[model samples]
Target: MTKLKTVVAMAAASALFLAACGSGDSSGSGGSYKLSFVQGVTGDAFYITMGCAVQEEAKKEGATVDIQGPQKFDPTQQTPVLQSVVSSRPDAILIAPTDVSAMQRPIEQATKQNIKVVLVDTTLNDPSIAASAIASDNVGGGKAAFEAIKQLAPQGGKVLVVSVQPGISTTDARAKGFQDAVKADSKFTDLGVQYSQNEPQKAAQIVTAALQKDPDIVGIFAANLFSAEGSATGVRQANKQDQVKIVGFDAGPDQVKALQDGTVQALVAQQPGKIGQVGVQQAIKALKGEKTETKVQTGFTIVTKDNLDSPEGKAALYKSSC
Candidate 1:
């Protein structure tokens, strides 16, 4: 063949090679992978931070991600949003189900279309649809809260649990764990559990009602970020902040302030950012037909006054921005 002809043939082959390797393509060296993320609710900054984490990490993986959620923490509201997200038929769907069972059918339906489904920051009742799940060990965190409160209260007086709405696996698990832990100690009295729907104003109202029912409440535990803040608000509004000790689940700027001010004794901080990062990587692995764990526990840590300035807390706080 002539030299000119050989050069042309080589150029054609290079173009084909680039296309196959995704060198010039949009998806991860190949082309961009469109991801659909359905969060539980956008009320608290924690979930927003979770979405940010996924977006940031997806950028690193060269994957495109879209995060969506309901305006509130209501399962009924999220159900339609999840359906809409699935309709787009993206490469993968990551979700924090509003209700464990309510979201099962939709997620399972998405899975049928060969779309990868990852459960992050929470789990669903129907487990088969999930390729992998990344969430904190809420039960363990609840036990940790109980232990901390126990140390502060040699003889427990009254304890109230302020939490988000029901059916969400993460919130439910933490509330149950806190209940179990408090029950384990016969000295403690349960003042009952109330749902805040993960709204600050609603949580404050719930706390106010609980205090009205029982004036001797001494220890308060909130199951998630919004509820925790609400618990603090109620205590302050009721003028009971001086008598009660508060322990919050999940961390945020307000929760950190609550801790500093000695209002929130400690915070059971979930690794929300890590959950996002881990979920996206697992989704990538699943897309590549690699083995992924069915249950991936990103776990959590207990943050208190002692470690507020420590390297671990600072590192985690910086990463999660909580």
Candidate 2:
């Protein structure tokens, strides 16, 4: 063949090779994969950071990712959003389920469609639907939050736990951890775990009631961001800032501000970004027919006034943006 004709033939062959490689497939191809990340709630710093991390990691893997969630952390609201995600038929889904049992059917349905599922940050009742679950050691973090409270109020008095409503695995675990820790310590008397349903106002009401019942309440553990915010508000409202030691979960902006202003003594900060990163990583692996750890435990840090300005503490701070 002429030199010009040979060059054209080589160019055509190269185009065909690239096309074959770029063909989207679940069988270990490096081509783009469709992924969806369903947050338990939108506009929350933890979920925002998780979404950012998932997008960042998906970019590296050439996967297209969409992050969607309910306006609030309600399973009824989240189920429709999840159904929409499933209808899109993405190759994989990484989700933070609002309820363990409520979300089971939807997640199992996705699995039935042959979509790989990775539970991020929170889990469902039937984890068998998920290929992997990546989240902070919530139980350990809860125990740590109580430990901080103990350090603050060593002479143990009545303590209250403000938590998101029942059925949220993460907060439930944290509450349990706090209860177990309290049970192990005779110094602290448990006031009871109050459900806020992720509403700050409800949490504040509970805290105020607890304070009314036992004005000598020494400490409080807020199980998540909204609960922490409400607990702080309650403490401020009751004018018990100096009297009540408050340890909270998640270092969101409000929680960090509370820590700085002495409303909250310490915060159990979960590595939500790390959870998202691992969720995407596991999803990719599962899609590629590679083995993945069914349970991946991310970590947490305790942020306090002492370390709020430190490098490690700053790293634990949550970001509102991707």
Candidate 3:
């Protein structure tokens, strides 16, 4: 009887222990909700920083997050990844669509599965399908890029834009904003926009050819990280670094190094971390059946060589990892 009593007490303790462990898995008032974050591409600093923020915010809410993306920023590759995530049936998904049109249908399927979808950093043509869309003011960031270039090249001359492919909503809006801003200013001549196809080599070739055609090009606005990197290299290869001023859109580590080395003049840094944080918040709100914001536009910072070490500049810079 003594042995049996001891065995029974041990069994009761084990059951309580198991129950406590299960409850500790989620601390929020609401049960744990699985979340998925799909980036425009894997290995990009901008998206990496956003993913880090998403993980941090999810942890605070006692939620679990899964981050995935394609090797390249292509809809063909991202579509498969999105479909796989949808099949897993996470409670919510946060994604940065590669192309505005191509990603529409794949994302629609997620919505049809009753998954709460949040668009972060990029959006589709039919964004109504998502619970909320959060991103920087891309058009305004482009305009700000032009403004930085104007400050670098006060006399203005011919200015050109090296951007990603046309179908990308963010880069396209950035190119338009820069071109429109240049058009408004008579001192600046818009040399038109060139597509880099998100290839650094292609962007470098484009910039080198543009410089060869018009050696007098004064300013260049690179709409994204690869474009800026290649533009800086092209200017250096042409030995025109002192002549052409470059304003890049994202403040990746490479872009900041370029600014420090005097290869680039200024950078427009978007609030990607903030975008990701808000994305998770919105997703949780939707999962909880609370009011969720349809659209949220984050802000940007203009980083230059002079203020590169400032607190704001440090905060604005993108992270390679969490």
Candidate 4:
């Protein structure tokens, strides 16, 4: 009888342990709701900060949020992660798609399964697949970037933009914004944009070539972090730090450091954490059959050396981890 009692007690304890483990899966106060946030790149500070905010915000709404992403910011790398997330059949998905066109089909699959999709940071080609698109105003960021360049190069000479691959919504908007902003003023000569394909070395090569071609180039706008890093390196290598005005996008640690050291004069910083927080909030709302906003345009912060340590500047910084 004592052996029987011991066996029964062990079985009960095992059951309790199993239940505890399953609690985190999908069981919440208002029933189970699972949210998955796919980052553009796992190691990227912007995406990490965004993922952290999404996880915390989802918890507040009694939902379990999972973070998934590729090691590299490539559409092919992201596709498998998206497919896996869909297979999990989460209540909602918040994703930063690598490419505008490549992500459309994967997002469509999620929508077909009734999974609420909230696009964060980046967007897809077809906006209809998403319940809501929450991101910084990339065009505005781009315009701000050029305005900084204008201030640096008051006389306005030849200016270049180092950008990532084409068809990536955020960078594309930024490039367009810069171009349009330049068009309004005839003083600044547009030297044309160079595609980096998210490769820093390639961006560096492009910048080096541009500098060699246009030694009189007055300003450079780097559309993303990698491009900015490469541009800074290129400018420093060419010994044109004083002559070239470098304006960068995304206040990642490297960019902030660049700003501090005068590698980049200014940064058009996106509110990635806010975007993530809002993305999860909107996803939860969609799951609850609430009216979610079709578009949520989070604004950007212009960070410079003067205000680098200020509260606002600190807010603009990105974290590598939650």
Best by lDDT: 3
Q: What is the C-alpha lDDT of each candidate?
A: 0.76, 0.84, 0.85, 0.81
Residue 118 in candidate 3, Cα distance off native in Å: 0.3
Residue 234's lDDT in candidate 3: 92
Best by TM-score: 2
Encode model 2's per-residue lDDT on 41-63: one tens digit a residue.
99899999889999999999889
Task: Assess every candidate by TM-score.
Answer: 0.86, 0.92, 0.91, 0.90
Ten-residue segment with the worst summed lDDT in candidate 3?
Answer: 1-10
Model 1, span 104-221: residue lDDT tens: 8877888877788889877787665677787877777777777767766656888988888778788778878888988888899987788887778898898888889888888888
**Candidate 3: deviation at residue 148, Å?**
0.8
lDDT of candidate 4 over 139-166, digit per residue (tens): 8788888888887788889999999888
Evaluation by lDDT, superior candidate among 2 and 3? 3
Clashes of each: 6, 1, 0, 0
- Quote model 1's TM-score: 0.86
Q: How accurate is candidate 3 locally (lDDT)?
A: 0.85
